[model samples]
Target: MNYDRILAARTSRIKASAIRELLKLAANPDLISLGGGLPSPESFPLDLVMELTEKVINKYGSAALQYDTTEGFTPLRKALVEYINAKGIDAGLENIYITSGSQGFLDAIGKLLITPGDYVAVEGPTYLAALQAFNAYEVHYAQMQVDKEGVIPESMEEIIQSYPVKFVYTVPTFQNPSGKTIGVQRREKIAEIILKHDVLLIEDDPYSALRYKGEELPTIKSMAPDNVIYASTFSKIFAPGLRIGFFVAPEKLGRWLVLIKQGVDLNTCTFTQALATEYLTGGYVSKQVQKNINLYRPKLETMLKELEDNFPKDFKWCEPDGGMFLWVEGPEGMDMEKVYKRAIEKGVGFVPGTFFFPNPGDGIETMRLNFTNIAEEQIKQAIKILASVVEEEMKITSIN
Candidate 1:
């Protein structure tokens, strides 16, 4: 039972994510959690999945249940090739590699490319899990600035040019925590910078299909195919439980990814891949995505309206066109760590923003609120409680 002594040096180098630690508190039924960026279970197409499962059994039978290639089930790869090409990216089955989820793809990339002390550029408040994945490999990270339009181009250029970055990591569409999309022009600029400087780019795009308002922007991969590694997931569109995701890498890089995957899981679930192949080829995915958008748009609108009405005027927050979360920043000098503790005691919860940053203490005044998981009334009440906590915290800080 002496686990501490047995743990490896790599394990000792990493700490548990602060947001994940907070999520454990959300288990209490009394808690109104705006914490985790979780999709609503109501949005999942359970009936369609049941139908798809039956179809998979009827069509593939024993083949669906058998082991698959590390490169993924062939039909699924073919379907994804067509899907990405339809989105205007020139892709083929050869460029695609399927994994358990987009998170798995991240891990594979870390395993293939990262060496200890290799510099990685990321949006200042990036996805915490990506940082965790890279950190496990002992990679160093440099933060890029993000504005309303997402990662700032000039900041990205500065970092890319200055650091010998292994790859520039980005969540171009509806970025996690911030909920901001990188504009089309900025996307082009990013591509140009990466191509000109010969730095690799990793585009993590899971929320592109969930857009409720903005015009679709071309992925960075489309702009500079040779330099960008594109990643997407079925979790946001179809179902997270399926654990299916795919990545598009240049031929050489993709070969390495496939080998890394073989060592990791041998392959993703054979049955699930067969089911997803049917779902995509049968035209169910588009409809499901639209259904998700329709369900979440009103919830997002309600949360934004409530925040405007309830929170103090000085508090700034992002009004994301689409995505599961909104980033809220309290007035200068107000620490979100303290605010989060107070809000939890009052029966509401949110992820404090510092957890998303590669460097802690940088986003101390902020928090990320998820609108997709809770009902409208719960959102209203949670925001009201959060507003009260903000006021109380501001008062306490002012007195000090």
Candidate 2:
């Protein structure tokens, strides 16, 4: 059919997500996956959700089922305003917008802001889906440094000065895959840098509500609301299947986002928005968050302890304050893709670090392991198997 000839050139920039691809392989019943950043099934308030679903359908009926505004269900927006405000961010309904999921916000931002070949400064090991989104817009990338504390503000500032960066994107709090948070002081400094450069910032924060330790820090949005376009979702706190997400932006940008969303999906699901409004207003989110912490924290600790007990002396990973993942760095030149293959042969699955890099061929020595989805026993088994794979690779490297 010569479909290539008819397709848009923009399509070339998009590729199947590495995690989604791995998830397909993880479908095997025997496979224990430390790959997807999935919430523990135990964390979902299933009974409560069933109740909410019935209530929404019964109370709202056709309104819950019918089409609504692109700006989202008003009750949900107002609830979000009160929610983030409790954490020190000042948001009004005018500042809010909703979408299919946080992933939608990424694509919409890419659509609204990215010009083909323009630069988007990102963490060296950033969220893969975000890179995928901006990539579809044919955006170039300036990779910045990251350590245990997430993005290094100095490195970000250097990239902004050196490149023609149109915007800066970060997953600051309990970041995906890496599971690191930018501390309050660094966040303040980073916000200052963004303001200085007059570049827009995208704070993709879906994990902050699942805190396992330490006091909660102020959001970058709170520090620099004018410059930061905040994106978060109900997927972690509630359920992923329903797929509702929220954003906070300046009025002009917020209006444009709503308008842009109108052309895309008209609005996020009314049923889910109604459910979310009830969930938030009913104070289910707070109680569910504590339940999630109780469920996930022990699994996180198990993985950390197993890594400490079984991994090679040179292999490194840090304990994140809270989140689903632990970023592991093997010796330089270690091909984690090879390790991933070996681990999978033993019925363990995880994401090789290369998939997250801004630059091709970077992150050969790393991998990201997710603990929340896997049971504690399975996490222990996966860690032991993965460690053995790393050791085997090290031995092979030594022989060569």
TM-score of each: 0.98, 0.97
lDDT of 2 by residue, 1-400 (tens): 9977998888887755555775566677888888887888877788998999898988898999899999999989999999978978888999988889899999999989989999999997899989988888999999999878889999999999999998999999878778889998999999999999888999999999888999998999999989999999999999888899899999999888877788889989999999999999999888898898999999999999999999999888978888888999887779988888788888999898888998888988889999999788998888999888889988987823
Q: Roughly what TM-score does model 2 have, to 2 decimal places?
A: 0.97
lDDT, model 2: 0.89
Tell me which residue pairs clash in candidate 2. Answer: none
> Which runs of model 2 end up more than 4 angstroms from their true locations?
16-27
RMSD of each: 1.3, 1.5
lDDT of 1 by residue, 280-359 (tens): 99998889889999999999999999999999989999888888989998777989988988898899988999889988
Q: Show pairs that collide, candidate 1.
A: none
- Measured on C-alpha atoms, candidate 1 has an lDDT of 0.90
- In model 1, what is the error at residue 131, expressed in angstroms? 0.7
